[model samples]
Target: MAGKSIIDVLENIPREVIYTIVLIAMILPLLRPLGLPVPVSEPIKKWYDAIESLPPGSLVLISHCNLGAYPAFDSMQVATLHHLFSRPVKLVFFSIDATGLVVYDTLLSKVDPKAYGKVYGVDYFHIGYIPGGETAMKALAEDFKAAVPSDYKGTPIDQIPMAKDIKDIRDFTMIICFTSAGETSIGWIRQWIVVRPEIKYLCCVLDMMLPTMRPYYEAGQVAALTGSAPGGEYEFLIGKPGSGIKKADAFTGAQLILLVFIIIGNIASIAKRMGKGGVR
Candidate 1:
């Protein structure tokens, strides 16, 4: 009865309908759980199998590229870290973003307080926050001690038992960057991967950015890329849906609902347009 066009009313209807559809999409997948078989890519499979093959006490470098408004990137990073840590890998935490320290500290506390408690410096260490974006990373590749004199806790690197003999980046086996930005990933590749071709690099990147980073993947510069929530969820469904996977499913459902709404709106728009044009 209102003067509003039929298209407008139809669009509005679909908007509400979409909410219900999204709920169904999410609830269904979560409840029924597709149990989709994970077709492991060679790179991802290599990274997984390689980490799993680590001799129980191998050290892994975990880099929080930067802090974000949402914890999606952080969640993905932590999920992968959890996977490795769950396998009992020794890890060291460092952040390129100053804001990341807060999130990292909070995440570490919730994920594994006991495992973290066991190896403060020996098995696990937080190098804390560092300065100088790419420049700092470049310096670290050459001489880590010169770049960061002390860990995030202000403990002198010389004092930490594990860091005593570790003078540079080469000390670690792999460099794992959980980042969304190009600079962070590229920096690692330029400073470490390019310089130290023998060392491995894996990225836990956000979903939208996956396409952008695909070139690196094709170039074989990145050893592995854990794509968005699908990657996280696949890992989870395989025995792991980390928060990344859970959030990914939610993201997928949201997109589906949006698409349905768009379709419905177009249909209503056509109907209204013809009605206004003398029922042609």
Candidate 2:
């Protein structure tokens, strides 16, 4: 990244004001959450409701496939996890992205501190980052424990309460791929959903991906979808109605700011084209 220079200095002046405005926009709405009925798209609603309805203690496999980024996606990840926790599911977390383990561990700590005692190697497990990405996914589908002998805390699978019963990938009731990347979701669909033809597969991804991933959802490859904070806010508003709702407001404000900037730029360009040199 470059340090501030003349143009950077000029640009940064408005940045602070814009940030404050955005902060207020987000905060005010959250403090008084819009209760905006962001219609839960059927897929997302189904996904959310499914997870919400799970019997407590149901084991869920959460894979972080994206190299965790931004508070929006990260927050969404946490929101998803919180939803899982609310259902009181036993979470088995892993990641294909090298940085994924660190992100999930951090998210767990921040999102639900009390749940930490859910036991690292017992109720909750971290299989750490697996290399070979897609190939590893295929391998795990065959023999999950063989692919990773131990969890993140260095405990053997046989010794762990959850793993003791989970002999292979088929053992998991559902697979939740929380990622911004398509690698895990696509691989799970190919190697697990298609091959096994039993276990449920859901994808929690960034909203920007909906266009491309819609086909997979339509094809029944993904059982459910929850992308971006709008989905998170929708869930939160119904329950806690906290940061997720606020984040949605900030998102709206940021979009408005961009739209204003675009309109101003277009007006300037039109003025110049009309030979007035954008004088106004």
Candidate 3:
């Protein structure tokens, strides 16, 4: 094997074989995760601590604005919901985007609050989707009930014991936004944060939007943030490994395979160049 040219071996390997190996690497993790250790980032740790530090009966407002990027943001949502539900906080959920309504329902179904001993209209309340964008956020900041009269299911806000006392955004101890849209957080900051500066604000955004949010996080506008991979990190931190861990395993495996291929290709090229020179 040492005598044989590495270039010959690598160059002869078919593209189909490479593709099959990559596919297997991705699928095998989904079936049985490798349970890879994901390092918790500072931002994610802060996000976790922000929630953990909250008093048991503290009120939390979750503003979900992700629309078409559910797959990317769903893990974070699920993990956050699990974390929140595991605690004794009173939660009020509302969506700024229309598509977020469906996202909220899907997320709720995945992280069934009832399973965590959370009762509907008591432990948590969903205000459904509000349509005024930044304007709606401003309105909700001033008077929550006036902005949203009913829950997602058409139950009046007053009917939900948890929500009846939430007169405005200031009533909540913390406000967290899980958004896919790049501009959604800005809207929250401008509308909600600006009005109620005392309330701590946290955000979970798509990984791609991390760059756009770093400045906000740095400026103390966003107390904490968890974007993309940090979702898995949060899952790991919370000790509840679900789809995020599985996805992280697949992601790690895929990257390793790609790296191996790149190294092999480079080695094969170098060997080929040496062989040609020796023949000359």
User: Could you say which candidate leads in lDDT?
Assistant: 3
lDDT of 1 by residue, 111-164 (tens): 784663456787778887777878888887788788878888899988988777
lDDT of 3 by residue, 1-280 (tens): 4555546777567789999999999999988988777998898889899999998799988987566878887778888999999998998888888888888888988898888999989998888888878888888888888988899999987788887777877688898898877767888889877777778899888778889998988898888976866578888899988778778888888889989998888877886777652321
Candidates' lDDT values, in order? 0.71, 0.70, 0.84
Against the true structure, what is each candidate's TM-score? 0.79, 0.77, 0.82
> Which scores higher on lDDT, 2 or 3?
3
Q: Rank the candidates by TM-score, best first.
A: 3, 1, 2
> Which parts of model 3 have CA positions greater than 4 angstroms off?
1-22, 65-67, 257-280
Off by over 4 Å in 1: 1-5, 8-47, 55-57, 116-118, 231-242, 265-280
Q: Locate the minimum summed-lDDT window of 10 residues in model 2.
A: 4-13
Per-residue lDDT of 76 in model 1 = 51
lDDT of 3 at 190: 94
Order of candidate numbers by lDDT, starting with the best: 3, 1, 2
Indicate whether candidate 2 or candidate 3 has the larger TM-score. Answer: 3
User: What count of clashes does model 1 give?
Assistant: 4
lDDT of 2 by residue, 1-280 (tens): 1453333333334666767865676667666666555554666577777687777777788886455454556655666776776566788888888888778767776667365446566567788888897898888778888998888778777888777777676677788887777666677888888886667787877778778778988887777876765655545534644455556655676677767655666765565566665222
Candidate 1 residue-wise lDDT at 153:
84
